[model samples]
Target: MDLLKKKILAEGSVEEGNILKVDSFLNHQLDVAFLNEVGKEFKRLFEDREITKILTLETSGIAIASIAAQYFNVPVVFAKKIATKNLDKATYESDVYSYTKGRTYKIKVSKKYITSDDRILIIDDFLANAQAALGLMDIINKAGATLEGIGIVIEKGFQDGGELLRKQGINLKSLVIVDSLEVGNIKFR
Candidate 1:
């Protein structure tokens, strides 16, 4: 993941409130080639798992999850953050508090997309407070789908997200972790 660490140092910026903004390639504007590499890395990390589908939250997690799904050869299922007219009535849902938005969101995924027999891998652009991941995990549990692992592009190691997941026995892999976000300096773990 040296390449990912390099990309972050070169293109990432530290915003107010400990936010490591990697919008250039990882979030807002995408770099597909780089994402393909990320996908491959995730597959390599979770290669031994029996993954039947990839699950992610909407918005930022969509692109990353979609690319990773290519490597896993599974369909991507995203929880809808905003209510959509086409969403199915029968759904698995959970509430997630957004650190950036400063509010809670009810994310939902159609019941048809997840089931007891499915082995799921969760993917996302970042993991800070683990709120989104927790919500997705709730949905996975509701469907009785087994969560094989979680692949994170960037993790704020200064936060408790990764630690919490690992403590819960989650196989969490983060491409790059920002261990420190001091005013003019940045550190990685």
Candidate 2:
């Protein structure tokens, strides 16, 4: 976690609205070594959980979750943000509001990927409003799957997302927690 915190200080940028732009290493421009470290840490955090699958959103969450899945020995199932012609019609759906994009989207996952017997671990690059996390939880609930835990790369602790999930009794873990991101300064907790 110290390594991740250092990476944030070294490369992360503070954007307006409490956003920490970690595009250089996290959300974009891929960092294989750092991702491996993230995977190992996630494995360590959820070592005792019965993780059968790793669930994430498409695009940004895919690479992170896929890399981490190597440690969990679980299949990665990413919910698609965009609907494609080839996508299965039978799916678990949820609506998500993207504060970054300033729009709402319907995320979907094929019903075949998750089942009642599986324990799912949700992973993502960031957690701010918890909309995406909530959306994923909806899908998992629809499938009757037990949520093992949530593993976040960078969490804006100033936001209510993490606390809200914890209050709901779902196991949530974030690697790097940002306490504040204002006026080009990144503060971590």
Question: TM-score for model 1?
Answer: 0.98
What does each candidate score in C-alpha RMSD?
0.8, 0.8
Give the count of colliding residue pairs in each prediction: 0, 0
What are the per-residue Cα lDDT tens digits for candidate 1 across 40-133?
9999999999999999988999999999998889999999999889999999989999999999999999999999999999999999999999
lDDT of each: 0.93, 0.92
**CA error at residue 12 for candidate 2, angstroms:** 0.8
List model 2 lDDT by residue over 62-142, tens digit each: 989999999999999999999999999999999999989999999999999999998999999999989999999999999
- Where does model 2 exceed 4 Å of error? none
What residue runs in model 1 are displaced by over 4 Å at the alpha carbon?
none
